[model samples]
Target: MASIAMLVFGGNAHAEGGSYNVDDASVVGAGKCQLESWLREWSHGSNGLYAVPACGAGPVEFGVTLNTGHGVYGPGVNPSIKWQLRNGDDKGIGVAVATAATWIHGRQDDAQAYVATTFGIDDARRLMVALNAGVDRIHGESTHSLLGLGMDVALTTRWTLLVERMWTHRTITDQGGIRLAFGESSLDLVVGSERSPHPSHWINLGWNAAF
Candidate 1:
């Protein structure tokens, strides 16, 4: 399975005055299920855990992510749906469309809609590049546009490198990570930095299992 990135915390978090975000564009295959969990710690004393369970049905994928923190806020949940418009092959490109709705215990709700496209850079289709563009609407606030660029390179049969940058509103975040795969599961370690407005840094340790 190819590594898919999940949107950790985004404009919704920012809307609540929090500064953490992760975004990705990979999908579980038809009739497949993916379980992902990660913990993100910020430079400041805030930290949280993001756990998501996603499944694929025909050309669409569905997921729900739960966010729990130990700092300035309570728990939150995000439910999302993604539709694969085109499936990329060894010689072409693939595209998907997604939307997520966020609800936090004491904050306004948020909704995000985006389009993702992936292309194979190698003949074996092991090297891939993905791009995402979207808009996030926070209830009672202004809408913000989101953009992201990422790449996945297979290092070996069971190892891959992941890198990406995401921009939403005036916040920009850069992330780099490695994925080690074993059969139907993988482990990921990621570190990222945020700039301006609320400058901060974070590290994410995660695991992904597919069935």
Candidate 2:
């Protein structure tokens, strides 16, 4: 449980501008859940488990944001790994791959890993194109698959924009969001929706800082 929280928090940290440097790659992310009801936590000893079991690895540093219309919870950890193919001058490029997984109340939950191929022009203007694919086991009885493609743009040194569309093999998802960096700290907001077979939405908001 503690480890799971740590991973989430770590992702949040990187998103918050903690400076994730991996083989020349630096990453930042922020967003909000489209719906609030889907984001629920386990009650102590109430879920018939010691804690939600989870484990993952990535850049060793990350940041996250969870947002609700009523309030916000943020700067969480995440599991991610980033590799920089080129890091210098105004032109830079890299590839980052990461995944974070957890089981809520033994319901068997998991999040797929994403691979982002990013390129930047003039250092401040960043463009990222990526894909996500993963599977989840639910209720010890069923398994679900996820696939997605997304893009991100840095408006400036302090602002970023992102848009994505995903499919769970069983459902469709639409994600749109933005990010802001304040010196050593950062914040993010994102909105998501299910568009194909049904109608649903979620939002996420997060904040984090460097060590």
Candidate 3:
């Protein structure tokens, strides 16, 4: 019942990775792959299981997001591709173009494309920043322009902080989270809010790994 409600308010369902609502301008690497999964519970009363699996080939990464409502409601899958224009290292600047198409079961389909930039401000502290500008086209509705900004700071060897905000014409969302690194994988906890006609607040716990 609760899952059905929030699935209707699918404003922050954009596919990136990790716990941020905004996508970043980085890819795993050539021949490298990653998997991200999370469990979310909304303050409005709902739960979801989300997964993302992606791999990099050449200058591009192919991925998809799986969003399910506790095995109930389905916005099913979001297929995405990211073309890395510049490496996101401690070099000058990094840039990428990302696009995704969404199909929510029984609901309308939507597609989005965005240009993103990432910068490494402090290599010692592992401080990074990312920004995005995009447009989302709804199947039966008008196109909505989107903007986003995000940051990640490594607080310590095992702990890192993340904050991000994304806005569209119809809705705005913000998220703050932390990651606890354990070698190749990490655990995540995120809390976020969305501003819309019917607001939804959620808490998410996630896992991320690279291979």
Candidate 4:
């Protein structure tokens, strides 16, 4: 249960700016700040609240996530950093590396790291695709490889569609959502399902802002 949230929301992208599960490249320009918050309800009698606040400095972004609620084993904390390697102009391939450590009840529980790639499909910047692959190192469990693929489409200035499917050898998760913008802030309504700890479905209401 905890692994699903961490990988789905915090691992590569960690709610990377907009889309839910797909890790997007850094967009927080130097000296800028942003906040992300979400309220989630699961079909199997569980719910949670999450908050992520982040800032940018040069090519790197620093952030942390606060998770709280039920049905989740470790609603701990995740502190992470991401570095943009190089921005691709001609091929539209942008790359980044993100790493984070999780602590539950004051004890380190797990660590995650991922290399993410974003590919632009058009010049208008209306559509984008992302790929993330990483390693999950739990305190007492054997390490596992994590991988995910996602895509987002901008239907208009105020509307965007997001879809993602991420997995490892043992778990699979799928998310679909719509983003509605209000100036520098946006709201999202997402539906998701995961195949771990039992088959579960959830809905999330998320809001993001840049400052």
List the candidates' TM-scores in order.
0.85, 0.51, 0.88, 0.89
| lDDT (CA) per prediction | 0.66, 0.37, 0.72, 0.72
Model 3 ranges with Cα > 4 A deviation: 1-16, 70-73, 106-108, 123-125
Kindly list the per-residue Cα lDDT of model 3 for residues 1-211, writing each as its tens digit: 0011122334254223575667667777899998888888887577788888888998898887778865345647777888889876566678888887766785547777888888878756388777888887867888888788888888999988888778776777878888899988988888988888867788889888999
Q: Which residue pairs collide in model 3, if any?
A: none
Give me the overall lDDT of model 4.
Answer: 0.72
Q: State the TM-score for model 1.
A: 0.85
- Sort the predicted structures by TM-score, highest score first: 4, 3, 1, 2
Prediction 2 TM-score vs. true: 0.51
How many clashing pairs does model 1 include? Answer: 0
In candidate 1, what are the lDDT values of residues 122-210, reduced to their tens digit?
Answer: 78867777777889776787988978777778899998888777777677777778888899877888777867576777787878777
TM-score of decoy 4: 0.89
**How many residue pairs clash per model?**
0, 43, 0, 0
Return model 1's CA RMSD, one decimal: 4.8
